[model samples]
Target: MYTCAACNEHYCRRGELEKTPSNCPCNETEEVEKFKELYLQEENYKLSYNSALVEAEGYCKKTRLEEIMDFANKCDFKKLGIAFCVGLNQEAKKLAQILKENGFEVCSIICKNGSIPKEFLNIKEHQKVRPGNFEAICNPIGQAMFLNNEKTDLNIILGLCVGHDSLFIKYSEAPVTVFAVKDRVLAHNPLGALYLSDSYYKDKLHKK
Candidate 1:
């Protein structure tokens, strides 16, 4: 029922609570109060507080990379981990190098770390991207376990596939953040489709 995205006025952002749409999420004051209290928990407090500082200080002024560094610095994280897709190995290397240069211990794991075949998941040969060829399933759980073993202070996901990223986040012991998402159709920039939803991408997206 909370349809904030459909609301054009966004009165909540302007603090005009009385002008907010009936189905606006902000109308759920009890949920808001509950989350407010939850945010004060030790782990949640650290993340929420430091993230807010990063947002305020870096708003429109700093790139996402810079803000990540600033947030890590503010959180006093000494080590970082990257769980990256095999397709984005080059990008992961560059990101790891940057983090290392910034004086943090960096550990990077590839999605195909375990060399697990798709057959292990009972995937049929016809279902394989290239039939009759070995296709390793993306091992997000292994990536998370590897990073967990490294005792990383935080984990960054570079380009994990949709469900793979979910598993990674679920298994990660440290906090996780996404550096980028996998979107082969848009050079990993999925937002491009949304930006053109009413134009070039409307039919493609709405196709049966």
Candidate 2:
């Protein structure tokens, strides 16, 4: 079991294992060597190098949108794709506009674009948010296919639901990044849970 989170001495920063706990992954020499080999690959090296540059350039200085634009610029990506939940259509539209203004060719797809019925997934009537109503399932695959057809260079997730975002990322051919995550009760700011973990949401998050 990995217990780095419970460790107090983070000796990995100095590339030293002297103070690493017994269970630390750093102690697993074979696995660490394999992971390093992966980063040595040409494509992997470029991806990681550019990601590091983006992080360093934008650290605590630039907004997320600005950072994304900077990163895309660095990667020379001309076309961008957005997969957004239906509930966040307005925000998606605004994001598309911003990307366009930033000189990117934007392709935006809504989660319910294909109009696939929830019944096709064998979901029971009671499973629907509103029973007896015609509900459309979120088609993350369709969103990815549409963007793939458009040959988008990078895909941005606006506010896809939890599992839906995973499906979208799985199906997307291009590199993916998340701009926002859907949190209906928290206005799409999921970190509110962490921010209040010590007080407001403590009992709910740590149930006895």
Candidate 3:
């Protein structure tokens, strides 16, 4: 049995334990530590992932633009795709521009690309952020398909809605990186929930 000490959730090492427990026993600090040790240190991808991290850190510390260019030259990536929410179009455009300036072939797609209505999927009209206005459904599948058609080597996500991002990752053929998550309150910083856990997010705790 594999037990998640932070959650007190036991896994039989079977096909189950797909997602983390909804009700975790450990506080945010403890959870973060366990996650770092397990995912960063022991994870299979740690070797390649940590090598990139170390290289990026060293590139930032001991390199000029020329050295950085030389470092990026080693990456096999060619075409880059950016899929972003319409709300964050400006930010996405800026990011695309930066990437283009850095010599990457960039392809940017807005969330409302196909203009497919949310009602088509049987989603309640009233539940939309802009009711009565023509609202486009978040087209994660389309975004991924479009990027796949473009044959992008790498895809970057900026401000994709929580569940939609998951679908995008599932469908995408290229490797994906998240530049910004869809947390509007914390200004793209999800850790703010952990930072002020004792105060603003005290309600999150099951027992106090």
Candidate 4:
């Protein structure tokens, strides 16, 4: 019902409440107050304030990695955690090196930490990506629990699969941020599909 994505005017950003569409979220004054109160909480306030500063100071001037470092420094989070997919192990190593160079303690956990078989989840062999072969399930819950045990100040998710990443976030005790999403088709840049949605991918993107 909230059709803000389809709105053209974007009166909310411009502070033109009178010109806002009927379905605009700005119309919900009560909801806004509730969110405002949430932002006032201790951890929430620090995160919201520092995130706003990171956005303003780095807008169009910093890569996501740089912004993440800047935000971490602002929040005074020293120990960083990485819950990464096995497919992106190399990328995770490079990121860990960079974070260490910047003087932060790094705690890294791989998706296949436990080496538990896919059958542990009752997944049939045919359902496996490669049938008749052993497949270790991606252990998002284990990653989160390990990071939690370390008391990581912040957790970075790298290239975890869709539902797997959700499970990681759900189990993580620290503040979570996504470093990259899995999209092997587009070199992990999923936005390329959206950019082509009205052109090369029009038919593929739209449901029949």
lDDT of 4 by residue, 1-208 (tens): 8987788889989999998877889999999999999999999999999999999999999999999999999999999999998999899999999999999999999999999999998999899999999999999999999999999999999999999999999999999999999999999999999999998999999886
lDDT of each: 0.94, 0.92, 0.74, 0.96
Tens digits of per-residue lDDT, candidate 2, 103-148, equal 9999999999879999999999999999999999999999999999
Pitting candidate 1 against candidate 4, the one with the higher TM-score is 4
Expressed as tens digits, the lDDT of each residue in 154-206 for candidate 1 is 99999999999999999999999999999998999999999998899999887
How do these models rank on TM-score, best leading? 4, 1, 2, 3
TM-score of each: 0.95, 0.93, 0.70, 0.97
Tens digits of per-residue lDDT for model 3, 1-208: 3236554435423434344454533334577677677765443354456447647777657543333333334455668889999989889888878778888888988878899998998878788887788888999889999999999877888899999999999999987777778989889889898887888788984356
Residue 18's C-alpha lDDT in candidate 1?
90
**Model 3 worst lDDT window (10 residues):** 63-72
Which residue pairs clash in candidate 3? none
Clashes of 2: 0
Instruction: Pull out the clashing pairs in model 2.
Output: none
Question: How far is each candidate from the true structure, as Cα RMSD in Å?
Answer: 1.4, 1.5, 9.1, 1.0
Q: Of 1 and 2, which scores higher on lDDT?
A: 1
| Candidate that would win on lDDT | 4
